[model samples]
Structure formats: C-alpha cells, structure tokens
Target: MTEQRLRALVYGDVDLNLIDGSAIWAQSMVRALRAAGCRVTLVLKAPVRTGRLVDPLTELDGVLVRHPHAEGLVDGDAPMTVPQAHAVLGRVDGDHPHDLVVVRGRAIAAALAGDGAFRNRLWPYLTDVPQNLAGFTPEIHGDLRRIARAARTLLCQTEELRCFLEQTVPEACGKSVLFPPTVVVPPELADPAPRTANTPLRLVYTGKFALRWNTFEMTGLPTRLTNAGVPAELDMVGDKIHDERDDPDFADRMRRALESAPGVHWHGGHPREKAMAIAAGADIGLSWRAPELDASLELSTKVLEFGALGLPVLLNRTPMHETLLGEDYPLFAASEDDAVDALRRAAQNPDLYALAAARCRAAADGFTLERAAERLRAALAEVYPQPSVAVAGPPLKVVVCGHDLKFFTRLLQHLAALPGLDVRVDPWRTLSEHDEERSRELAAWADVVICEWCGPNALWYARHKKARQRLIVRLHRFELESGWPQKLDIDRVDQVVCVSPHYAALTAEATGWPTEKITVVPNWVDVAQLDRPKLPGARFHLGFIGAAPSRKRLDLAVDVVEELRRRDPRFTLFVKSKLPWEYWWIWKRPEERAHYEALFRRIAASPSLAEGVVFDGYGGDVAAWLRRVGFVLSTSDDESFHLAPAEGMASGAVPVVRNWPGADTIYDRRWIHRDAGEMADAIEVIVKGGRWDEERRIGQGQVRDGYGLPRVRDAWEEIVRGR
Candidate 1:
C-alpha cells in the first residue's frame, strides 16, 4: 500500500503581514508544520496588505497559503466574529476535510467548538489567557469551558499557561501540549555583532508602544545610561497605535517623549526581517513592562526574537523570563532604575556583556524551528498512527542512533533521500544506561539499526536486539581503547563497520568477535560543499581542526609551525577547535590536565610559537574556513579515518598526516610523516618548491573519488539489504 501524505489546515483571524503576536504565531506554526512533512493550508480570515502579498493559491516551502477576503478584515484589528469565522471555514473545507484543523484565536475556537464536523480534528492554539476572563459572566465562562473540553489537543505557549488552562478547565489537562513560538536562522547569518570597550552600547526595542509595555520608561533609558557616564544609544523599531477607547492621546504623548529623549532613534515601523536585522546589529534588546498590566504568564515572543538574533535581552524579573533565561541572568530588572544600572554595568564591563550574550544565544537553541517541529511531529504521530500493511516493496525501516548529531545528520539526510528507505535518527548527547527504554523503542521500530559510535547505543542494541532485526555498529579509534567493546553481545549483532582495515583488526582483538563480522566502510564526505577556490595568501598558512584532548598532539603542530616560521615569518598555524580546558571532565583527569597545562606553558614561554598560533574557536563554517587554509595538519597519535584532513583535501588543501596506527590504511603514504620535523619538511617542500597547487589538486581528486556521498550510500545499501 502507498503511504498517505498528512494534511493540516491552520485557521487564524489575523493578517499574515501584520507585525503582531497573532501573525507571528500563525506564520511560525505554518512553517514548522510544513517542515515536518505535512501538507499545510493556512487559511487567514483577512488579507495581507503589508510586505509581500500571499496569494490565495500560493505555496511557500510546500505550505499552501490562502487569504479569504482582501479588505473585509482590518490590519491590527480584533479577532473575527463567530459568523465570519464559520463563513471562512465553510469556504475552505468544501468537499474534503483536513486531517488536522488548528485554530489560533479564542473567538475562532469558540465558534468551531460545537461543530460536529471537526469533532476529533480540532486543535486550539491559545496564545494568551486574559486576566479579565477570570471574572467573566457565567454564560461566557461556559463557552470557554466547552471550547477547552472539546479541543482534540489544547496547545499552550508555556508551562505556566498550560497549568493555568488545566486549572480553569480541568478536562484540558490530559490533552494540553506546550508549543512555544520559534524563529531559526543559520549560524553564519546569526553571528553576533562584535563588542568593544570603546563602542557605544546599543539598546534596541522592537514592539508596539502600548502603555502597558512601559514605553515611557524605556524612552528615558538611554539618557539615564548617559548620565551614569556610559556611552549608550537606543533604537526603537516600532510605532505607537492610538486607541481612543483606552487612551486618546497616547500616540502623541509617545512621539513627544521620543523627541525629548537624547540619543534615541525612533525607526517608526519595519517588516519582521528588517526589525531582526536591526536587532542583530545592536548590543542589547529591551523588554520591560508594568507588572500589573503584564498578563504574560507565558513568555514574551519579543525576548525570543531578540535572542534568535544573538542579542541579550533586558527583560523584567518575571516568572516567565526567569524560567526561560534562567534565574541568574544579570540583565533582569524590575524598575527603570534597575534597568539603568544593568545597562551601565554591561557597558562598563565588556567581559560580563560577552558572557551574557553567549548565554542568550545558547538559550535560543531550545526554541529553534527544528525543535518545535520535533514536538509537532511527535504529537501528530500519537494522534494519527500509520497503518501496518503488506506491500510489494515496503521501504526498509532504518534507525540510526548516535551520541553526536553533528556526525549523523548529513548521513541521515543521504539515507532519507534514497528510494526505498525510511530513516529515523535518535541522538542522545550523553548516552547512559538510563536511556534503555528510548533505545528499545527505536530498535523495535527498525528493520535495520545502525549505531554511529560503539558506545552505550551500540551496547544497548547488542543486548536488546530482536531476532528479526539486523544490527550494525560502527567503531572509531576511541571506542577501540574503551571498555565498551568487551561488554557488547557480539552474537546479537550482524555486522561491525570500521572506517579502515587497521581499526577493524584492532576491534576484533578487543572484543574477541570473529573477523568475519567486521567490515571496512569509508566515511562519506560532501565534496561539492567543500570544493572552493583558495583565498589570497592561503598558500603559506597551516590549519589544524579538532584539537580537543591531549592525544591530538597540538603541541606537535605548534612545533611544525615554529620550525616553518624560522624559514619564513609569513607562515602561521590556525587551530580550529573548542579549548580542552573548558570541559570539566577533561580537566578533572590528572594526567590529561597536566599534559595540556604543560603544553600551554611551553607555548607561553616561546615567543615565536605563541605569536604564530591563531586560535579559531568552534564554528559551523568549516567549508569557508578551509578556503583560507593551504595545508591541513593531522598530528594525532592514532586514528581511524580522521575526516578533517579529507575534508580539507576536498577544499583543495594539501594533507599533512602524521604516521599513526591506522594512518596508512586511509591516507596516501606520501602525505604521512614520522614526526614534527618530517611534517615541517613536507610543508617546506609544498611552499618553497612551488608544489602547493599541484599537491592540492592531487589531494582533492583523491578525496572526491574515494569518499563521495553517492559511493558511500551504495555501499551502505548493499550491506543493509544483504545484497
């Protein structure tokens, strides 16, 4: 039987282009559901008038976008009435009903709650719970209770809101799911703006100037910071909307306040992308509001938006903010005076500001679109389970388990694109015996299970494998020395994959497993992603990637750089890695700690070695970084197909591999060196002998032919299918 595509219908009363909370929530939801392999149709009650117009039949990233009326609904208006919502739903759901119907606004939810057509398909996404609703009349409260009880799934933005809903309507407790708003950008684009001691502190605000937001107090922040002897500026990127019923002169009053404040630039209004761009270039984001009027038990989306742009936020000290940003976040404030002091301190102390900014960036990872999609997919899977059926050629269910997602994400992508394969990935960063239940679930769902590393995941599958399930475990260099190999039940596993024959032999001896069970499979590399032209002045530069732990022999790399700098001062060593001292586990080991400590001491004592070495911190742009590195050095004491040199070689960089236990099995013999002196001699030949370009071409050709993704995929398929 052919698989059916999952379909979802998202209904909202807000205009898609409006710069409001409802629009943001609706658009993000649509994008996330679409990314999770659902055919989504977004039905908006009003038309989009600002930015780009999303046509009624237009598709975006596989999502079918639609807006019913062009001018019937006003921008930034209240939610649509019951009759209007019914008309829109009737037009959209003509003949075939959607598998899932997600409504955003409370008014829309109330309208559809009693409709028998949407009985088990309705999912109400509540963005806000108004405090005034607690004192509602009996008739109105009954409507809310009915809506909450009738929803197939009640989605809340935060845990506090979820709890609040369960208290207000007890039946919702069982069906409620916490679904936070999300915004995701690539690392290269989301890089934080550089901060320096001399640079003026830039504070940004990007929301409506409602009186409840305490815009009046925010207008005076820049002046207050300046008076405190700190150079500061504020960039306000929104406009004040006038509501005659609430406050007739609020917009004029805000305009006058902005004019009176010095060093405050009022950038009236901007689209979402423009606003995020302005925020990304700034140093800080402001999210202050009056506590009495702030009904946000759920998190403020503005805080998350700024964090997604890599800016630390200065939000009020509320329960929601504390939960998301942590209790110890230094930028939390309760009053204008507190905010002023926080800004002053951040401006005066560069290190403090950098640390806080890093924390904010780290916090943003939890609310990424990818994570949001995972939640949605899990929820949908529970609601709509796939049917088990016999077919002519069923897709092979393959589950790839790993501790590091970075190593397996690309490989999973390759597997997912294959014709007759269904791949699922389960990544446990610090896998232990406690994760046995999760491992068992993943293993039971697979026809073939491949463990990326010979760690806890491999051991779990080895002990728990079903007779019908085919198990494969891949071992790298580190696993060969670890005690995990001896504990594995080799009888349960079908195959053990090694990157090189040398490691295959070592693994067989370590585990006492038959040699027939071991096989060599080269790691796949995306050659196209790495093949870039060399940057200017890259010929003399030497690069080392992954310098963690003491066994990497980074000191040997420095020795090679020290020798080369004697002949020519232009040669430099660029080391790309996370510093080993940052990890507590590595530093706690006495021998490992002393080895790195002494290595740093030697570098500190040598002027040439210290000056010639450049530490490039861990980053995602390896392909771009390799362009500036002419020679890639691998100075490890042992190895099982170290991929750094192969990746560098694909980028037209000459490989300089040190002779190790398995180096000969993977790399060409000519590139292998016995010691630092031999490595320096190879570098000298490449540079002084003018063989840089020739060696680069040869290395690139070798890696592309040997380790390309297509060749690796074919080999994996053959082993997995037992063909």
Candidate 2:
C-alpha cells in the first residue's frame, strides 16, 4: 500500500494542538492505517496553526490532508468548533462514498450522526468518557444513543472502557471494537541500557505533571531509594502542569519538589522523540498515580512507551495493570510504602529488574505499530464486506398494540427507525380493551401484529389474526395467573414471549401452553442510561424502589438496614419510591395501612433505624438516583423479573435479593438470600471484606452482557422479522 491508497479512508479528530494522549494516539493510528494498506483523507479540526507541529503523518505514503480552507472559528486560538470539523468531513466525502471514515469526540460523533452522510462506514474512536454519575445525564444519554445508532462500529481505547461503554450504551455493545493505544519504539532504543551496580537507578516520568499523576510524590523516590542503600536519580520530561481546582498551592508545591528535591533533573518539555530519548536511558519508568485515578478504565500510555523501550514500569496495581504485568510483576504498588519497597527491591535485585523488563516487553508486543495495523486492517476489512444497505424494499408493516408499552417503547423506537421496517403503534385503552374502531383498522393494516401483553388485546388477535399476518403475543407475570393465556387460541399465535425462563416454564405448566411455542427474552435494563459510577460513600447506602403495595416487602429491606446499623451505624437505607399514602388504592386498604403504620412505629422507636432509614422520594432521573445506592435490596415475596435488582446491577450497585420464586434464575445465586438476616450478612461481607467494588463490576458485567437493551431488542427483532 502506498500514499495513493490512503484517499479511500479518512481520519478525523477533535483536538488540533496535537499534544495530549488522544493526539499521540492519532499520530500512531494514522501510521497503523498506512501500514494497513489504506491511504486516508486526514481531516484536521483546525487549519495548521504553524509549520512546527504540522503532523508529519500528513506527508506519509498514500495520504491526503484536508485543512479547513474557509477560516473556521477557532476556540480561543488552537481548537476549532465541532461544526467546522464536521464541515471538513462533509466536504471530503461529498456524494462519493469512502471505504471508511474514522472520527473522534462526542460532539463530532453527535454531529456525524445528525449529518447522516457516513451512516454505515463511520467508526467513532471515543475517549473522554463520563467518569461520574452526573456525567451520564439524559442529554448525554441521547448523544450516546445517536452515536450508537449511526456508527457501523465503535472503537474503545481499552477493554475496561469497552465493557463500561456496553453497559452505558447498550446499542454499541456488539459493535464496539478494541482499538487500544499503540507504541512507536524508537530505533535508537533497540537495546536498553543495562542497569549495572554502582550506577544510580534511573527513574523517569514523561507526561503532564499533576497531583493525580503523582508527579510530586515521584520526586521523593530518588532519596528514598538512596536511603535503602541504592543511589538513585529522577528524570521528568513534561512541561504541562495539571493544577487541582481546589488546591491553589499544589502547583507551587510540585515546582518546589522538582527544583529542591535531591538528585532530580527536569526537562521542561520536548517533542515525542526527544522525550523518548530521555526515557530510553532510564532503568525504570515512574507511573504510580494517586488513588483517585485507580478507578479509571483507561490504560496508561506512559507504561506502553516505557515498555516499548524495554524498560519496566512502576505503576499502580489496578486490575488492568495486573493483567498487563501479571500478579508476580515486582513493580506493582498500591501505596507510597509499597512503591518504596518495590523500587528498593528492584534496585537491589538485578534478576527481578530483568524479569520485570522482559515481562513489560512481552506485554507491549501486542501494542506495537505492526500489531495495531493488523487489527485495524482486519476491522476495516470486516466492515467493508457488509456494507450498509439502505432501506430498499417496502417497509415491514408492524403494529405493536398493547396498553402498557412501557417495556416495548425502546424496542418500538428502534424498529420504527430501522432501515427496512415501517412500524406503528396501536395502543389499547386499557389492559384488556381498546377502541373498537381504531383496533379493527390497525389489525387489518399491519403485516405483523405484536400484542405486548397477553391480555384481552392478545385474546382478540389470537382469534382474528389473518393467516398471513404474524401474531406475537408476550406473556407476563400477571397474565399467567389471570387465565389470559388459557383463554387464547394457542395455534394462531406464531410466538409466545416470556420475560424469564422460570416464568416461561410456569406459563407452560399452569396455562398448558406448548413448550415449543414459548421463548424467554429477559427484561432489558437500559444499561448506559442506568450505569454510572457510584456516589461518595455509596457502599454504606442500601436502597429499594418502593414500600407501597405491601408485597414489595419494604419492611424487610428496613430490617436488613437496621441489622447492619446495629453493628455499624454508618450503614444507611435510602427508599427512593412513593409511600403507601401516595397511592390511594394502597393507602385505602386497611391491611396495607396497618402494615406501614407498624413499620413506621418500629423505625421511630429505634434511634439507629430513625436516622438510618431515609425515604428519598421518586425521581424521574432513575439513572442519577441509583448513584446514591450501593446495595440494591429486593426482598419481595415473589416476582417474575424484579427489574430493580437488574437496574441496580447496571448502575454499579451490588444486589441483595430475597430468595423469591425464580429469583435465583433471574440473578446469580450468590446475590439471592434466604431471608432479611442472610441479606444483611451478604451486605456486611461484601462491604467490610472490601469486595464491594469488585462485586459491583461483576454485577455490571452480568447485566450488561445478559439483560442489556441491545440483547432484548435483538431477541424481539428476530421474532418480529421472522428470522
């Protein structure tokens, strides 16, 4: 592949300064694309501000650079608006379709989605993901949905980020590919300098100096190593300083550390090559960051750079890092003390240093330019064969007729927007009835009729459905016991959808429905909408949806919280739901009122319970509301799907489920408890034993993979399309 071939593909990024990690990635990936046998239309976010940093990749083989000739509005000076960047994309790909167009930035991704030009060939390489609960707002959620809806594939920088993305935006679940950071090893560093005895153990850090980067703490390394009987020196090569917003003196302190700390040399800043040259001479790289950054799903590019130069990296022992360097890697550190011990041990032992270096080299092998090129090439090629086909034929006539389309709306919207499907909704007036005139009109018009609930609407469709029209009726928990399924004519319906396998089995047994006709499609949790990082001290906050209607067993959840607070008053329960009095039907019932009255009296009697139990009323922002909850309690008497636990799991909360009928089938056996006491036992063990975060991730993985909207949508689509 030569420079001529690069024109078939395009690469666009939002950053124009070409400095940060994202810029570094662009430089590396462009080279990988060149090697992958595709010439590219390199679209810059802004016009080249100077000749000094005009990316050399623009002049590479098979490359065409598109600079915004019309002076676009520059942000302050360097960055261009997303509109200008998008305009560049439009100009380059006008009418004539390219093989692929890779873009970046959430804003530009949104723009590309709205432009509707590169519908099928767009690959968005994303970074700067939301790190907190408040970040995944409704607007942000819509932006992600648009991106997912537009792109053929999404590229993530790390596996962890991809997992988070899937949970955050389920539509991107199967489409996302790992496009991890790549390293360009300098040829001059082909052979790493030997760390011989009597020579100072050189520790180098190359990046922006920041509190979270632990650059200030890095200055203390040389002296601490010297105190341990091994003389050391520190080299830092970055000019940018990230000041903590709340800490005005942080930069001053960092400057003092770099200037006055013993045996420390600082190179203000240099080009990538110049910086790598300094790092090449070092024996080890310093990347042990602060605890705050440990929660990040991104991989450290510094580690890859160091490893590319055959140097071991001293970094935090995060799961991603551990997987990269293994459990036995000598340089993994958790605290300042661990860092001192690890560095001292590596300095004293040549064998351990050599081992870490070798392991680091091996870990970095898969991230080289050659490997990345191969992966990128294959990903592009895979997409090329299955080109986006426009909605060609007559739209598949679909009518989703039901009273409660709450669960069906997400699927309906997807179907309505699909290329080949013409979808409509014929909502029933109530659970068992619809307007006779409108219902008759819809039934005749639809090629496919979906009765969302197996209620009266389904019963009517089962008898009246045309032989040619495909009728799909879904059975829920209430219908199985309400005699609706038994009343319907079984042979007319093409498919019977159940939310869970346990319910499907019960439906088959109790209603005598044919086993072969029923299929289980679990209720979806809008993972991306629900899943966000937990709030501060969420581990101590237990939560449940509501206490109303009695069967939900809100009192049992209070019991668990009361039990936990007995041992540790720090534990608290947040009830984010309407009370019995809020619902007239529930409040009017003498039995329901009595149950809540007794429960309130008990809570008022105990000081711990009074303080620990809090009723945080219903909020439309379920996604953000879940952030305050660490342990989601599901102590219901019985349920078909019990959506709360799944939503909680998606939101990075550990679930404590009562062993209601089929609860084990819906959730992992570990989360299901026999009683309130056992639920409290599980919560205490997960929290006190320091496995809450781990459990949180596991829960997210489970929900994201199994019950995410994409999975459920696919299952429903297959049945609807007769695939």
Number of the predicted model whose lDDT against the real structure is largest? 2
Candidate 1: deviation at residue 51, Å? 2.6
Clashes (backbone N, CA, C under 3 Å), per candidate, total 0, 8
For residues 1-723, write the lDDT of model 1, one tens digit per residue. Answer: 114667889987666655656666777888788877788988766545564324422647568766555544333454456677776685677577887889887777877887877766788887645555565667656666777767878887876566556556655744677788787564555776576568778899987777778886788887788779987888887653545457778778888877668888888766666777778778899887777745565677778877777788887877566656677888987788899998888778777787777777877888889999998886675465332222238988998888775565555655665557788877776756346667678878899999988888888877778888999988887877778888888889899998888888888887889999999989887675567557667988999999878888998999999999999999999999989878788888999888888888988888888888998867655766787799999999876788999999998999999998888888999899999999999999888999999999999889988997556766777776666
Pairs with steric clashes in candidate 2: 3-61, 3-62, 4-62, 5-39, 6-39, 6-40, 7-39, 168-528
Which residue ranges in model 1 land beyond 4 Å of their true spot? 52-59, 70-80, 131-140, 186-188, 240-246, 258-260, 293-295, 388-723
Question: What lDDT does candidate 2 reach at residue 605?
Answer: 98
**lDDT for residue 533 in candidate 2, whole number 0-100:** 52
- The digit string of per-residue lDDT tens for model 2 on 233-333 reads 99988766767897789999998888889989988766677788899999999889888888788898889989989899999888688778887889998
- Give TM-scores for every candidate, taking all chains together and pairing residue i with residue i: 0.52, 0.64
- The per-residue C-alpha lDDT of model 2 at residue 138 equals 93
